[model samples]
Target: MADQLGSARRLTTLDRLAGGSKKGVYRLRLDDQTTVILYVWAADENFWPASPTVPDDPFTDASGADLFAINHAALTAAGVRVPRLLMLDRGGRYLPSDIALVEDVGEVTLEALMARDPVAAAAPLSTLGDSLRRMHTTLGSHFGKLAAISRGEAAQARCAEDVVADRALGHLDAVATRDARLADAHDRVVAHVRHLRGAVSARQVYGLVHGELGPDHVFVTPANEPALIDIEGLTYFDVEWEHAWLRLRFGDAYPALRPVDLDPHRLEFYRYAQVLSLIEGPLRIAETDFPNRQWMLDLAEWNIAKALTPL
Candidate 1:
């Protein structure tokens, strides 16, 4: 690590950063009183337990330095701000998997700032709104992960809406086996999704989405710049999908991330699908050796209630 940063700025200490489920994130303190972040794509650090039962999709355990680099480039091109890339190690020279060195944009997430002082956090939050606009307006001819699409590796799979519906139903079935609440609400949930899905009109063009944008994923720099992180799942899809996430995470402040033309049917349906995903995903993680089992179950329970809500 010191060799990568050159001899002048030798690494003095390393501290693991939180919220990285698919990769190892560490902060490197150098002798020069500066810091940088290192992202390791090692398999051992990943928390998502692989399943042979589930059908594959774009959002499945989205990770890797290739995805990061591609998404970073595309997002930057679209005027969305991300951490500055210092270096990327893809060769087996470092660890078995890929790694990256990026600028330390600070530890204060927009979520934290908003929690600390809602009034003062207004400026940075507004900047994030612009970032979302740029990302939403950047259209892609086809839908898929930014890396796969860039490398011409994207499959001719079903449209984004269908993918959401299929995954929602699959999760519905799986969650039923694990939780009695899902088993009882199974038919109603299916009916709600199918009804909303039917109301959604099809479209050809797709826009870039952060896929899982939350205030927690946004870091506000000292200069008041809001930079996006943990962006490996970045994809080109229906903008409504991203809006659904923003509405959930931002809650009342969702209007800041703007677009007046979102389809109501798609937004409602996707929000429910996202809730189903949250329920199933956390339970799957809790089954693993990952710590914080209680919190994961709590999240699953919260989302389960949301999924069972009347439409």
Candidate 2:
């Protein structure tokens, strides 16, 4: 964190930067009248196992800033609402697998705004839907396939494979093998994800989608314009992955907006994928919110029963 005057100045101290699982974001005021943003290197150093003892291939926040900028540019070029790019740090060399940089954008994120008023949340949902439709209809073909080994697939085959493996052997025992329920109830989530995948994609139907569609990545500005951020997981395979995710997080509440059309079987698979993502991420975020583990168990049972149903 260094700050130099004139141009290409590095900000040592970010006024107010908040973040979650992956990156660090900051708000800065430039010499100009309008305010801009600065995003820097910030990744979980201890995220993966055995990395610390080894040569170190930790996920860097350095390269991602540029990638995110590029993604924003691409989406913006396609008539989407994204922060107007002022500058990108191309001069800085990477420290093997490290990333660090800043991007200047206008206004606050939809998530931030929604923090003030829950009812106002619906506005961003509609904008997200419209933006998604544009991306899918126009650039869907360019997105990566959501595979476990694929370049940018986030929580892909892991959850589905876990659940299927569990159910194949038995019920409870199988689930435990897939997920360890320690401080948090991970087993029930694993079972739920597997169950949904089995029910939906049981007959073999899968397709393209946004890959990871959640509120956190979607941004709504002061002007009420909706824009999508964080597209590292822009993927193709498993339409159900997107549908189920949107459903659990936002779909159930917003019935007026229908998820993209896919075959019944594929849709079901997506549902499971989403449930797994929520369990792994948001559910983890709200683990203590639930009174007991029974609540999670109930959700697993419900999803499993649904998955077992014929599509």
Candidate 3:
């Protein structure tokens, strides 16, 4: 990989980073002391795939890598702070799965920054809000996976309501199959989402969104700027969803920075859809050979119960 990037310097150090289910992250230091983050998409057939809640079909390892690369470029052009895409090999030519080499943003994640000092983190969190607003402002004519746009498939564009409806229905099916007790609540949420389809579909705004913007994926630079990472699930959808996730995740920790007026109904529906979508992960892992299978099942049940409760 270093040779491909035109660097003949031998790698002096390599350390694996923690906490990614779908990708292996590593920090590599060349003999010359230059550092870069190497991201290799997970290709194990049994490792599971990209989130089904993402707009359009779930992504395979190769396709997900391509989408991540495309999304990185698009987001960078939209004035959103993200790591520089130094090199990419979406075809898995040099590794077991597709790989990307990106500029190292530093060792600090937004989560750590927040924990270290909530008072000082305020400025960066606010800046993150602004970055997210810029991302939502980057519009697309179609409402689905951003990768589809590069393929000239705008004709298959869907309305935001339709996308959310499909995701909600899928979540309900997955959750109900794993736990029968929450079936009634799942059904009610699905029906409510269906009821709002007409109103949500009529809205005209469509823009790119970081479907998963948890603090782990947000890195705080040495200069105190927020840079986004792990963008495999970027898509075009109602911006309200992004704001809702931020508000739900951060609460009063970060000031609201939505670029447009948020509709209370739309925000609520999307929030439910978001929480429901999260249930799929634990349910899937519960069926695996993971040592913590029972724990995952318990967590899944807890999430299902939480989803059923009023927000």
Best by lDDT: 1
Question: Candidate 2: which pairs clash?
Answer: 61-99, 62-99, 62-100, 63-99, 110-220, 200-268, 240-270, 241-270
Off by over 4 Å in 2: 1-13, 31-33, 42-63, 90-124, 139-210, 251-253, 256-258, 280-311
Please provide, for model 2 over 15-57, each residue's C-alpha lDDT reduced to its tens digit, 9 standing for 90 to 100. Answer: 7454433444557665444355655444442121121111111
What local lDDT score does residue 36 receive in model 2, on the 0 to 100 scale? 58
Instruction: For each candidate, give its TM-score against the true structure.
Output: 0.95, 0.58, 0.85
Better of 1 and 2 by TM-score: 1
Task: Give the whole-model CA lDDT for all candidates, comma-separated.
Answer: 0.86, 0.47, 0.72
Residue 94 in model 2: lDDT: 35
Q: Considering TM-score, where higher is better, how would the candidates rank from best to worst?
A: 1, 3, 2
Per-residue error for 281 in candidate 1, Å, reads 0.1
* Winning candidate number (TM-score): 1
Write one digit per residue (lDDT tens) for candidate 1, span 1-311.
Answer: 65666776677899998888889999999888899998999999999987533343677767888889888998888888899999998997777889999999998999998889887688988888888888888887788887777778766556678888888988888889899988988898899889878988888788888899999999999999999999999988888988898899998777765554788989998988899999988989999988778999999999988887774
Clashes of each: 0, 8, 0
Off by over 4 Å in 3: 1-9, 31-33, 49-63, 91-93, 184-187, 195-201, 256-259, 289-299
Task: Give the residue spans of candidate 1 off by over 4 A.
Answer: 52-56, 155-157
